[model samples]
Target: MSRPFRSVLYIPASKERALEKARELAADAIIFDLEDAVAPDEKVAARATLSRFLAEVDYGPRLRIVRINGFDTEWGRGDALHFGALAGVDAILVPKVDGPADLDAVAALTGKPLWAMLETAKGMLNAGAIAGHGRLEGMVMGTNDLAKELGSRFRADRMPLQPALGLCLLAAKAEGRVIVDGVYNAFKDEAGLRAECEQGRDMGFDGKTLVHPLQLPVANEIFAPSPDEVTLARRQIAAYAEARAAGQGVAVLDGKIVENLHVAGAEAVLAKAEAIAALAE
Candidate 1:
């Protein structure tokens, strides 16, 4: 089954305390951040600290991703080389990726799968190419930086960001790549976070990136399949199977018709639900 990415938490690589605490967090994935989270003076030291922690730690079933500095910065190349060589990292997140060329540059240095951060206007325009890149395993919406570039005002509903978000979503879906929503900055506002997480979930995001561990429960709960959804999915699958057995083209589920396409979607939901359950175990 495809792994669930309901809550992808970002932990600054420089903080050993945070790293230790992360192993116990309920995040489906952990992003050991070596980019914006690290200070200029701490860049080199942060790498060593993260390296040591990774070597000594066991993060269980949680997917471990390393967000390296961009090659535009002096530390970016070194971060890539270091983490790319490490076996603990599942994928290397390349920040501010404008197109496939950015992924190609890093692909040369690392054999690991890449995740692109679509933060710039250029990146949004070339989302298709980036998402379809051979080495790219996922796409991350870098909404904060994208807003800065667009000079767009903040809306609780993210109105200004919808077009960009939709474009990236379509790109990821078309290429069958996993795309996660951007961080919800207000970690203290659980109500706001739930609203945004629901929005992302409705928009077909695989998950939501998190800035703080406190946000995990909300994202996790919001993204996972609901009990009602699971129940409906099982019923749809059973009805379809029974209809197929009797040589019918379609089956009625509730008041609506259940076709092969509906069964496919229902199976996907159950697959995701099972994956989440496996992760919990």
Candidate 2:
């Protein structure tokens, strides 16, 4: 069963306070981040801090994901090597993944689900091959790094980033892997965040990766099935079933043709709704 990825909050592993606060947060997943969030001076200590905390704490309901540094980095190998019998880790998020070989290297080091961050120019170009890797369970957009690599300024619409975003989305969908939209840097702009989350959903992303707990409510609300959507899903399923029983090949709902493909989509919406409801319990 795939758990909800909506509102995945990233907390710096070096920050003891943030880690403790995460236990009570409403995020569907908590990413204990050792990369990007931690400075060069605190890399080793952060890893140790994270390991020690994970060993003792029980962060129930929140999916425990650890975003380790790249394998090519000095801290990466040691981070992967010292799994240290820690419990409650659900996945290992590897940053700057260029291709399948990067996943292979990290997959060999840990038995956890591998999530690749497609950030670089090369990674975007190789998204198809990377998503096809057997160890890969998801793809995370690293738009900050990608924009820096591309030398493009961030726009409200993300017009320049759309092509790369589309490629990653298509790649992940092709392989049936979870793919999440990158964080919005403007943490204070609630309206802007809402707009971006809506865009991501329309593009078929599973969720939006978040940087702050304040972003959680919007992400969860936007990604989950709306009440109207759930109602429409139920209606579509019922209409389709009735049509099939009456020896009809198709059903019409809201004046549009509903086919087997549409029914499958409706079922998926209901499944996600049920899964979210179960998680709340």
Candidate 3:
């Protein structure tokens, strides 16, 4: 089944309480972060904590990913080297990926699928090559770092980030890789998060990366197909089928013509809804 990545939550490996709480979180996937979320002194210990937990506990139906430090860093190489032994991990998410070479290095160290972080300007330029990597499964936006690199402030409309985000999205989609949007930093602000989530959805992101558990419900809701959307999709498909049966060239639903393209889009909505339902199960 195609997994629903509508809400991917990042949990700090150094925090025992947060890690414990993650087990019951409703996020579609869990990124047990050993990189940005952990302090320098705690990197090694965080790795051990995450490794032990993965080997022992089950995260239920959610996809379990581990975000390691950059390969250029001391801790990054160690994280990749030991991931093969970390049972129950679904994939290895590498931070600050600039090109295919970064992914190639990590792939050599472990056999798991690699998820590259599309954060740096250099990475944005080489997105196609990064997404085209044989072992790459998806790309995650690193908005905070990207914003810093671009020297742009956070605007609710995200005008400054559009070009870069679009380039990354196009590269990922062109290669059939699943691409998720970057996180909304204000974890405590539901109104802001909802607006940003809606924007991300409208812009074609499969999902949004989240920082806190409190943001999960909003992200999950914003990304998933709504009841009205599912209804329209079903109606469109049925109308098209009925038209085809009667030897008509086109079908009309709610006064709009439904073509082959419309049917395909409708089918995709239903497929996504079904996938979300599977995750709930």
Candidate 4:
């Protein structure tokens, strides 16, 4: 089945206003953060706050996720254990995931779908194995951590991370799992944000992990099928249908061969667009 998980927004667990604001946002998923966002002294309080909020809030149809700290950290394990039994959490985002073992350990702790973060060098190297892990639901790119760990400069085009990005995409696609792009750090530059969102879309991400509400619209717009694209997809499907009725295995559309594979691709695009449109209504 096609899951609508576009525009995943990150809401810091320590920020009450941010958590409340998520209820009113149009994100398809909300990632409640217990790592990076909270200070060392605030970890305990943050976990309690997140648990209480999750237990009490009505998140409607939006998927609720919690980004726990790395398994190596005490705070991370504590965050996972505290909310692992909570009812509303749809998935647990495990950072610094290096291999299948990490996923296995988390799955053992909670049956919740694991959204493994491909951040470190080891994680990138083992992306295929990690994605193939039995209980993984998806993969999220942790570009900032990855950049730091790899000692790579962040170019505007993200040239340094291309290999890692491709590996994550290949692994996720092979396993039939959702793949989301990393957050664009520049929240204030709307134009730059939109450009990066478009870049992520071009790279074949299912959606983008957003750090701010303003980024939501850009990610949604970039990921959503354009009117022209939808029209062409429909045309391709109809042409393929006519060809099939005539006992032909392939047909020519816009000077390109339209086969069963092409028809399936077109239909998938239409389905994704329809699902996204339905969410708006």
Candidate 5:
């Protein structure tokens, strides 16, 4: 079964407490951030700490990803080399990824799956090429950096970022790669966070990157199939089965046609839900 990567939580490498607390969180993945989260002087120490943490922690079934410094930085190579050596490390997240060359360079260096963070205008423009690059497992929306680079204000519906978002989704879907939406900066605004999570789900994101623990529930709720949806999916599967037994080629349920494609989609949803529930238990 494909692992469920529904809620990705970012923890600062320098914040030991936050890193420790991650063990108790329900996020599907934990991103050990060494770029924007660490100061220049703290980079060396954070790398050491993160290296030790990765070597020691089990992180249960949650995927472990390290967000290394941009490849252009002085400490980028060091961070990549150290974190890439860990046994449990699932993927390396490369920040400010501009093109396929950047992704290829990192993938070659680490020999691990690379998640390219599209955070700039150049990155957005070349998203398709980057997603198609070798060893690229996914692309992440870096909304804050994209907004800063474009000098555009944020809106509730993300009108300014629609094109970029759509492009990333298209490329990711084409390559069968995961696409995670960016974090909502406001940790205390639960309502706003939920709204944005719902919007991300509606926009075809596989999941969302979260900055705080409170956002975990919202992300999980938004990404997981709802009760009504699950019921409908179940009905679709049953209808298809009954039709096939009756030697009927076409099946209709609730005035809508149910084909192989619909049955496959419903099965996928049910499979994911079952996997998540099994993991929780």
Candidate 6:
């Protein structure tokens, strides 16, 4: 089973305090942000700080993805070359990836698995090619930038962002890569955050990228398979097994048909639950 990324928190690499504090957080993954979080003047120093921190400290079980500056920026190439072969880094997240060509540029600098930030209109349009890139392992929604690019207003349901979100999501799924939802800006609002987490979970996001530690519990709880879901999955699997034993193609479970497809989904739910359980250990 794949690792669960239910709560991915972004920690500014320039802040020693934030990096130290992140070691204790229950987030499934940590994005050591080297892009927007760092100031232009501090960018160079932040890289050294992050490299030293990763070498000296241990962030167990959780993934360590470094989000490098976009190739459009002067610092982008340096960021990639610096963190590309860094020991603790798990993946290199390339921001504003417009197509596989963008991945190609970064791939030349690093042999590490890549993650793309699908924020631009052109990136969203070329999502399929980007997601299919051999080195790409995941996709992250950059909603704030995408909104700015579209000159769109924020709605409670994020209706304006649906098309872009769906396009990237479909592309990621088609290519069998993990896709996470964007951060909800109002980090302090627990109710609003929970609502959005539920939406992302229902929309098939592997997780939600978080802005603050306060948002972790809600995202983790909402994204994880619920107790009822686990129970239902167990029942479905049992029913399907019994049907197959009887040389039947489908089984009736709680008035619904359970076929091989349903069993496959049920297995995935159980596998995810198991994976989440293991993450806690």
Residue-level lDDT for 214 in candidate 3? 92
lDDT digits (tens) for residues 1-281 of candidate 6: 29998999999999999999998999999999999899999999999999999998899899999999999899999989989989899999999888999999999999999999999999999999999999999999999999999999999899999999999999999999999999999999999999999999999999999999999999999999999999999999999999999999999999999999988999999999999999888
* Residue 281 lDDT, candidate 3, scale 0-100: 81
Report the Cα lDDT for residue 155, model 1: 96
Once superposed on the true structure, which residue ranges of model 4 sit more than 4 Å away at CA?
Answer: none
Better of 3 and 6 by lDDT: 6
Clash number for each model: 0, 0, 0, 0, 0, 0
In model 2, which range of ten residues has the least summed lDDT? 79-88
Q: Give the TM-scores of the predictions, in the order they appear.
A: 0.99, 0.98, 0.98, 0.97, 0.97, 0.99
lDDT of each: 0.95, 0.90, 0.91, 0.88, 0.88, 0.94
Please, what's the RMSD in Å of model 5?
Answer: 1.2
Give per-residue CA lDDT, model 1, range 200-232, as digits (tens): 999999999999988999999999999999999
lDDT of 1 at 114: 96
For residues 205-248, what per-residue lDDT tens digits would candidate 4 score against the true structure?
A: 99999899988888888888899999999999999989989999
Pairs that clash in candidate 6: none
Q: lDDT, candidate 3, residue 12?
A: 96
By the TM-score metric, which is better: model 3 or model 5? 3
Better of 2 and 6 by TM-score: 6
**CA displacement after TM-score superposition, residue 23 of candidate 1 (Å):** 0.2
The sequence of per-residue lDDT tens digits that candidate 2 reaches over residues 1-281 is 36888888999999999988889898988889999999999999998899878887878888888899887789998777665135668888988999999999888887888899999999999999999999888889999999999999878899999999999999999999999999998899999999999999999999999999899999999999999999999999999999999999999988999999999999999999998998889
- Model 1, clash count? 0
